[model samples]
Target: MKHLLYLFMLALPVVATAQKDSLAGAVQATRPLPLYRPGFALMLSAGSTGGGVAVGYSVSRSVAVRVGANLFNYDGTLKSGKDTDDIQIGFDYTVKLKNADLMVDLYPFKRSGFRLTGGAYYNINTVTFFGKPTKDVKFNDTVFTIDEVGTLDGKANFNKVAPYVGLGFGNPYTRKRLKFMVDIGFFYQQSPLVTFRTTGMLEPSSDQGSVIQKNLEPLKYYPVVNLGLSYKL
Candidate 1:
């Protein structure tokens, strides 16, 4: 992918000159030029945020738009320090994520290949985390099975909507029926809400989920890097 990006970047200057020559020829003729804008494309994107497919449209040489969805998930074990009785507590869990967005891409230079993009999205990116105790938990001096101590779970949600900003290669409105592009950017979201708690067994009276919320505060923003192939229609 890296090599492909390098090759694409190297070819842009040549492409611009060739395209410019074609435009000059078109202008020299008496006939009216054919409409060359308003093309559509199918695109794929991938990064830390996840992977997704999108359908895009070029409204003009400098303006384009697209929409798509993506998914991501992870799992692991977690632990905390021993309680006063010297008993350790741990849990095994999984987290699933989802996101969607509507984006507009803008190319500032009249002939350069770079694109500046920004848009608002009905962002549904969020985390669903759930876990079961790793072993018996001791409470009030009594050791109990993880079953007796209950399972812990929660949904961590970010803002339903967010703004996105990114830069990319290939005009959002590529002239070729097939072209490649690269983009790196992020979504600015608000602090996540981790409403985790124990369920269906020995429930602790204290609000222990606060610690988890504090730990998750840093994930308020989502970063993305994408490589794509688009076919104009």
Candidate 2:
């Protein structure tokens, strides 16, 4: 009996070593595992400084769609005079765009059960602009006045829609409680409905509140940047 007890003790370490080896092998095998799930995501994006958010739903492994909105504002100084401290040029332009997009993911990489995806996308965007500003301006030979503040007011406002396409990248959804990603892309399109409302501080005030300076200019096709994130359910 004493001899058998010694043999069992000697075999215990061998068994433990084998179990450890098996566990390590299993971990290494799952190093590249793909994740699959039917899910949805909430995305927020900022590009060239513009900002927005989107909501998307994944119907299959390679296809999904989303819709979203964006808005931004900028301010600066244009010029000033000797008596004047600083003639600030504030561009209070607000851009509102409603968008719908279709996603196609091709490049795929899996690590630690997470699947990463990259592909191309097409989006249709409707953009609108609302511009309002206030400034102090001097006439050809007259001194600037406090009432010039309202006189300097102007606006460029209109709405239009366009279509564009670009590359997109993100993580594929897994059958998990939560998932997230970021997307950046380029777009080419045109906006035809942009109109400018001008005030006559440099000239004279008309009976009408404001006047359209010129016909709306079409926003030509150009590259755009986007970023976003999402959650899975």
Per-model TM values vs. the true structure: 0.70, 0.48
lDDT tens per residue, model 2, 1-233: 99999999999999999999999999998776446666677767776425766676776665566666665554433322244443333433333333444444443443332233333223333333332223455556666554554333344432333444455556536544444454544444443433334453433433323222332233344345655555654
lDDT per residue, candidate 1, 1-233, as tens digits? 99999999999999999999999888787564343446788887676766778888877877888887777777777776654434445655565557778888887886676888897656666566656656676668888886776677677777888888988887535445666878788888878877766765635732866777777777776677888777676
All models: lDDT?
0.72, 0.48
- Write down the RMSD of all candidates, one decimal each: 14.2, 7.5
Clashes of 1: 0
Off by over 4 Å in 1: 1-38, 81-87, 137-144, 199-202
lDDT of 2: 0.48
Top-lDDT candidate index: 1
- In candidate 2, list every pair of residues with a backbone clash: 155-197, 187-224, 189-221
Among these predictions, the greatest TM-score belongs to 1
